[model samples]
Target chain A: MSHLKHVAIAGATGAVGVEMLRCLEQRNFPVGQLTLLASARSAGKTVKFKGTDVTIKELKADSFEGVDIALFSAGGGISKEFIPHAVKAGAVVVDNSSAYRMDDSVPLVVPEINAEDVKKHKGIIANPNCTTAITLMALWPLHQAFGVKRLFASSYQAVSGTGAQAIEELERQTREWAKAERKWDDVRLPADQVKVYPHQIAFNALPHVDSFLDSGYTKEEMKMENEGRKIMHHPTLRASVTCVRVPVFRAHSVAVSAEFEKPVTVEAAYEVLRTAKGLDLVDDPTLKKYPLALDVAGKDNCAVGRLRLDCALDNGLAFWVAGDQLLKGAALNAVQIAECLV
Target chain B: MSHLKHVAIAGATGAVGVEMLRCLEQRNFPVGQLTLLASARSAGKTVKFKGTDVTIKELKADSFEGVDIALFSAGGGISKEFIPHAVKAGAVVVDNSSAYRMDDSVPLVVPEINAEDVKKHKGIIANPNCTTAITLMALWPLHQAFGVKRLFASSYQAVSGTGAQAIEELERQTREWAKAERKWDDVRLPADQVKVYPHQIAFNALPHVDSFLDSGYTKEEMKMENEGRKIMHHPTLRASVTCVRVPVFRAHSVAVSAEFEKPVTVEAAYEVLRTAKGLDLVDDPTLKKYPLALDVAGKDNCAVGRLRLDCALDNGLAFWVAGDQLLKGAALNAVQIAECLV
Candidate 1:
């Protein structure tokens, strides 16, 4: 972990990419040099890393020439088109998109849960979904304690997961609602003026978090099952999830009822979660305290609270977990994977 | 069924009470005469009814005199204090509060599955929890078809359920954020000016919905188990729920994964829900269509979509349900219960 490596981050101007840069600095990652890459539109941009300016380069197949590790936070299409080039250029690629997640050849790594999986990566490792990674931070520790078999989860996903545009939309619409400048009845905004989401997100909940699948579940909803099975190494593990986009700016929160093969008591689950790495126990009902998005917005560790028995399922426990979706879900997880590699 | 009856609505100045007024007009409930009652603060306030002004009378022991039926949407304290008075005045009371919900003598009603439960009410009938009611609107119908035994649900509750002040707070903070009037550090506002909710409701998710109980579950979370048993007539029916308050202004949505005694199929569940009363099936995966808060905000019927089999549970099916929390979760459910009595 002490050996320095030259690293390049694609989509350097994007939200997750920026967070990746901050995470690398905050964690004091051993970086010999940093390369920032973006589309030609952002080629001239400069990002400050370690109090030094790093000019953004136009992302191209040749961009990975001198990079030992390439972290890609760009869209799936961009990763699909360029990740192979990075691998071919002799750089290990860590992709934060769905492009290579389900690929048998690519390992999906969450350092705490499956760091060893990274060793098997064929030059490319896929990052789990933001919501799934945050949830597994708490669930994996409990799974080790209780042998979890299945889970039912509902996510309160923040707008930042949709990118910078959606965050601005929430800010814009909220102001509009507050000023009463736009009554609910006046629906005549121009196309450019219309915000990120299909509807105003100021004071609303949208059930459609991602694209819908043929099975009626959104892609975000299926990620838990698909990615969970891959990460947990449980081919038969079951998951029923509903992903909702809330007005929250950052952090993703999930309420989960996980059924285990063995009986799970709140005390035992608490013991495991309290000491688990990257996890915090916030389950104090007496003080009216628990893990809330505001409390975990910029934190590294995911908070787990509201732990109890699932009254409906035998040997099942219900809990609520919150984590900075940008950190644990994307940037931090990617950096952790890089750390495990070195 | 054709006979009209004089109906009175208590707490006419409240959030749900106003929604009840609109629902009655929207559904065209058979009404011979209408009475609106409120506290002293709202007494003499004029509300429109059938294009005529009806002045609110101060709710008193005698307010229900000659009123054939009464819908109570006031807080528990008011319901506890005046529900008996309304009953003594010869009107059946359909209460939308927890005052009598868990009482052994009271019948917790959801018209579609438990309309018959109304006959068992001892002068007062109780509406289920907003989250429970909305989730069960879809689950109960499927339960009747599949013999449901257990459920795991997470609720995305709206701030409106907290009452009008919280709604105002969400709007206010959003506007404040939009205007950039206050950074996250500016905290000089007076305590009274802080407005509804213990924390800011804009751009945040609060895991605590209602006050917490000794058992660590919120009163809002336990409503599903306590009220669910009575409404479903399955004293042993199990439920594990995590209730959360989002910044949404109107609708309450729930993600439900229910397990039944018999084998459940998405096809069969779809068939049952397609014809279920008080529910609209809005599932269309390829078209990216499904139930959402924005779509169900001002509507009466609960909108259900994103239906599928639980990949995690045998004999389990997962679905998403949303309804105007103020309407079906409170006012409309109470009015429908009153309609059943007449």
Candidate 2:
């Protein structure tokens, strides 16, 4: 292996894929060579990296021949089909898809919470869900202090989380509203703009995210509980989440009410969180300082605010958390795991 | 009181007040005389009701002399100042403010849940908070079937809930984005557009609503537990809520996870809610037919969907509810109380 790693990004033209490339550059990841991989349609395209253009290559089983590390941001089907081949070719995988996340052989890792788990990866490490990763960035510190048992969370997720197509869909619908000079009360999307999401997402709140399960929870909603337990190494962690797609372009914000096994005061939780890495304490309501999605759009650190004792529960704390899903939730998290590998 | 009572609307130029006038006209309340009241700035403006123009008069202490029923949509401060004058003038008041909702002498009512509480009013009947009203519309019948113990809720509130000025702010911000042809990734408001809200609400999610209380829950967030207990006659009920102001224009949506004393099945809750008054159950996920905020805007009935047994809480159920804050949350609820009185 080279002293500088050979890093490859799958689905190089996608939204998260684009961010993954930027994260590699901005974080100054050691990249002796960079391979941009996508399907035939996106192949022959060139994406600029480090002042040089890297030509995209069509991904096949032989694509990882000389690759030392593979970052997968394509959908679950693509990851499931291609990851084993990457592993067979002697490349370690950091998958952002859910295909192998729950598998015993794959270690689901959040670097701030469980960076050590990255070492436990057999051939693959899975990035936690966007909402789960952002929420746990704050919750992990609180859990370390108070031992969280369960939480109720609702997400204000971005159109970008659905990938590049959904972002364009929201933009198109919004442009349609603008072209027609529509009133705020008269918001509607022309049918063409509703292609990406199940419904129109511009200026609307969608209660559904991902596919629904027999349990009536979306695949996105249950990730907080299933992924939280795995990533936190707490087998009994429970979460009820309503994953909502809002009109925001990039950041995702979560409103969380967490119950702890031990008593928690706002000051003590603040003490634990102020020193926690990869998180910011933004909780001055008098000055109207709290986490807002727009403020955290390009930020690497997730912001936590609205810290209060939950008057509704025993040993409970309620707070708001927001982060750039493209950064902490996906690309940055995946790269941080590889940094651990190095 | 005469069979055809004199009706007066304070804050007649505001969003909820305009809706209140429409509710009276559409619901065909027996209005012998209609009195439209606003501040001195809006005085002499005429609002058409029942195909007749009613001139706006400045709201003063002596304005309610001949009024038999007064509906107030003004802020809490205004409500507190003028409610006594209205009551002392022999006008039964239905106030849509927080000024007296918690006052022991006033009856806080959601007509479907507690119409009988209307008869127990001592001169004034108070309306529940908009988000609370919309949530309880779905939770009330289920509470009848399952006996709710506590709830955790997150709200996607509309700008109109903050009154006319907020609606204009969102519209202005959106128009600014359109005027500048700003990209979705470059969302920011000029300092002027940030007048109504503490921050830019367009393409963003604000976690602050109403004012911050000492416990860190906004006044709007705590309204669910406080008002739900009064309306449902469940004094021991506890609620933890995160009230978020989204860029939505009209409807407010709530995602609630409620624990009940008796075990709940989706079918049982459906059976109760389908037959309940002023609610429509929209929960078939296969067709992608859960409730969306856009689907409920301008509608009188609140829609409940996304039903499933909660996996996070014992004997808990989770659901999503959407309703127009103007109709079911405020105006229609106030008019319904008047109907009960008649």
Candidate 3:
């Protein structure tokens, strides 16, 4: 293949898909050609990429004709349907959905933690879940320093992680309250008004994310341990995560308490995270500077802060990690994986 | 003390103080006399209680002359100063500040867990921290049933937990975005606009809740284990909590993964939590019903749901708890402690 390769993005008009375009443009991927594919509904839409308008074409099994690399971010069903067609058409795929993440043949890559795994991919490389990817950006360094055994995490996930429609849902719901001169204490929209989520997302926290499995864990909550083990090559990594959707627009933050096999100190964890790749140590508590979702909204690097010794577990460390999910969790990670290829 | 006793509220103009007034009125406490105390600036303001307007008076060292029970929601310094005067003036003081929470002479009470501890109070009682109180409402029952050993918790705490100024700050910052007719994708206030919080609370999550201690954990995060042990009488209870301040106005929600001494099943946890005092089970996942922060905003009973066997730990269970911090965590709990006196 030539250094300047042909690249196609499936679901090119969605939230993550658009960010992938930005990442490609920002990273200056040597693109001989760029193909944007979306649903028939988004077919006529044109997105600006690097001072040029790229028209989005209707996505189909035949969409990947001469593409050297296909980035899939539509959803699981779309990836499951069109990925084989892309692979059969001779394009290597980097999927951003969960459909092929746990597949043994499809290597799940986080770039920083397991870039070498990219070489093991048969055809499709899987990008991790947003919250899992953001957390591992920090936890991976600590795990390298002090072998992590198990962790308990809770996610403050943003609405944009759900898609563009979910973002509109939050804005519309909140704008409804704003339009009415209601007091802050009494700010609420009707339950019937809520569409994207099971409940309201404005000024509220919904513990339910994705669909609930039979075991009472949401599929989103289970993704951390399941995907973390695969990416970190730590089969014994245990994670109990309660994924909650907050009203934040784009970034996702995770609070994690991890127990380690080796003795860990705050200073030791600080040293490891200070030099960690794709991560920033923002842990000066006295200055009231920590990793906040708002601060990390548009950044590529996930920030780690609020480092402390876990009082509940022996040799444990607790930290908060935040990142722009559209970037590191989905697009930038997928692009980084593609960079490993070129 | 008579069945109908005199009640005085210190810091009656504050958020929890106003809620305390409402709780006393709604719970139909026999109040023969009512006195409202506040700072000198709010001394002339009047608050309505049970269809009667009570003028606020400046709280002084001599304000507790005939009060049989004094509820203190003032800051810690006020509690430390005026509480001694109130105690000397023959009033049983129920403090909402953290100043005397760990005092050997003061009995910190969460009525659901330790109503009997109220009987042990010599002259003053302490209410648990808001997040800690709401979490323990659910965790204590599980501990009673399964003998909990340790737990990891992350709190999605509300702005109202910080009091009135914070509630206004969230509304003001968000209203600025809405009034400007800004796009939702660009909704943000200037960092300087953030007043009550160290940073903007609109569409953001702050992991630093309360002051930082020498150990790197915020004072709010450590309160879970410290106050949990005192309230539940579980001396060896271990809790690693990441206390986060979210943009929600009133209710606080916590996601907890607790390790128990005995093997536990989802059915057993459901059995235990179904009939637990001051906790409502809202755990039908198939129906898309779970404990949400919005639903529990003004509710007294903390709701627990999203129950599952913790995949991370042996004999572990993960669940979520949400409640109005003002009611159960502060105002209502303090009033219940006063009710024990009558």
Candidate 4:
């Protein structure tokens, strides 16, 4: 444990970067030194680390020289450009971007599901999509219990997954509506109101999450099918997903109906989830207790509930899963990968 | 059209009641006269009708006198107590509550799916749940072409379905959050801090929409399976639903995977939905267009998109549907029943 390592976090001023700092503090990770790096726009900004202020430096190709670990969440373009440079600097990079997740050379790892996959990483490890990570958190436990064949899933994804700008957009539009209704007198818009999204997201749900692919599925929607196979080591696994952006600020929730090759029961699922790591069971429907975003917003483990047998398909189970998108989806997953390396 | 019937509306100040008024105006329903009724607390309130103010009368056993059509949406307790009275007063009742949906004598109608069921109504007709109605709007069309067998659905329900108060609750909480984060010091909390829900709704997604049942499903979740079978006239038709409450002010979206006896294809679904009344096709993924709550907020027709083959099930097709819960789910459906009678 005393063999601590220095960590450098790219996009240190961004939402996932903030979560990375919190995760390090929460997990008591062996952080010999911390380097906070951001873009030129965020350079010189100070961030608090364990009650001490750390000034952010502009990220460059040479910034990772002394850093043993590099966590990147500054979007795909930034990660694509800087990841190679960091890896060349001899740092093990855990990237929270889709740029390299599907790259054959990069291993996508969800530590709880496939930690051994980390050993195959070619300097850079990819974090699975928030929806994929949250869904697999519940599905993996069941997949181990019953051989999963296919899945039909719909995600109620939080706006935070889109980044900090989208979160501000939701809050800003919601306040605008409230003020317009004469429900309150105070009305103020955020100074930077560049529509990060196509539509106003304050009090609405958008079906188009990310850019649409040639297969007619949004980038976010195809992630479960594409990333799930890689993380679960199931090359032939099938999934159809509808990823939706909801007004939620934090946690992402997924409703899944999984079909397995073998028989599965609600009782068996409950038993499996109870002892599973990175999972919590809040599925007592009779008591009005189930996995909700509000309860799972700040938590590390994904909350799964509403588990029942699917009446429509044989050997199918229907369940609802929720987890903090910023945590399991991005920051915590990257940190967990770093932990595995240590 | 000269024989336009006299109409009465109970729960005239509620969320659905407001939509009922708008739907009647938009569709130009033939009405000899309009009677607005509400509980004692709101009896004297005035609501707009045909650009004129109509006073709300106290709803009682004799309040439906001389009325030929009555639309009830004042919760199940009020509907149960007043529906018989309205029936005895020579009025045909269309209820938007769960009070009589499963009753043997009551006919549940989704005008597009089973308008013929309206003729079977013995004085009272039941409206399907908002989520159930929005789901079937697109499904029934596909079901006709494919001979539907079963469905797995998850609803992204709006706060308005909970009533006017819940909408107010979402607005209030949002404002509270904005004021607390006084980036703009001008924001202040509204004087009336009334709570319509048990929890803060803004920036959060509540998995529990309605009251939980003994069978581990919310009352809202079971509505699809119970009311759907009744409305579809398929006593054995199966549905598994997970109803979620989102922060949208209007329009409920549902992701559905339906399995039919016959083969299903995206092309065939496109054809079925294109010609289907009460459904608008919004499924072009290339343009990043799909059914969204913001787009369907004030629309009568349910917007259907994300059409594809369900990879998990045999003969299964997956799609996403969004519709204004206030309109098709409540107001428009009720008004359509009146149109059928005319």
Candidate 1 wrong stretches, greater than 4 Å: A182-200, B1-6, B26-33, B181-195
Q: Rate the local accuracy (lDDT) of all candidates.
A: 0.84, 0.93, 0.92, 0.84
Rank list by TM-score: 3, 2, 1, 4
Instruction: Point out where model 2 deviates above 4 Å.
Output: none
- DockQ of each model vs. true complex: 0.57, 0.83, 0.86, 0.51
TM-score of candidate 4 versus the correct structure, residues matched by position: 0.93
Model 1 in CAPRI terms: which quality?
Answer: medium
Which candidate should be chosen as best, given lDDT against the real structure?
Answer: 2
TM-scores computed on chain B for all candidates: 0.93, 0.99, 0.98, 0.94
Q: Candidate 2: which pairs clash?
A: none
Q: Which tens-of-lDDT digit does each residue in A189-267 have in candidate 2?
A: 7676689888888778999999999999999999999999999999999999999999999999999999999999999
Q: Which ten-residue region of model 4 chain B has the weakest summed lDDT?
A: B182-191
TM-score against truth, every candidate: 0.94, 0.98, 0.99, 0.93
Residue pairs of candidate 3 with colliding backbone atoms: none
lDDT of 1 by residue, A209-311 (tens): 7787767677888899899989989888888898888878888899999989998889999889989999999988767678888778888999999888777
Chain A superposition TM-score per model:
0.95, 0.99, 0.99, 0.95
Q: List model 3 lDDT by residue over B202-235, tens digit each.
A: 8999998889999989899999999889888889
Would you give me the overall lDDT of model 2?
A: 0.93
Looking at model 4, the pairs that clash are: none
Give the per-residue lDDT of model 1 (tens digit) for B25-86: 87788888889999899998899978989999988888888888888988899999999988
Q: What is candidate 2's TM-score against the reference? A: 0.98
- Residue A45 Cα positional deviation in candidate 1, in Å, after optimal superposition: 1.6
The lDDT of model 4 is 0.84
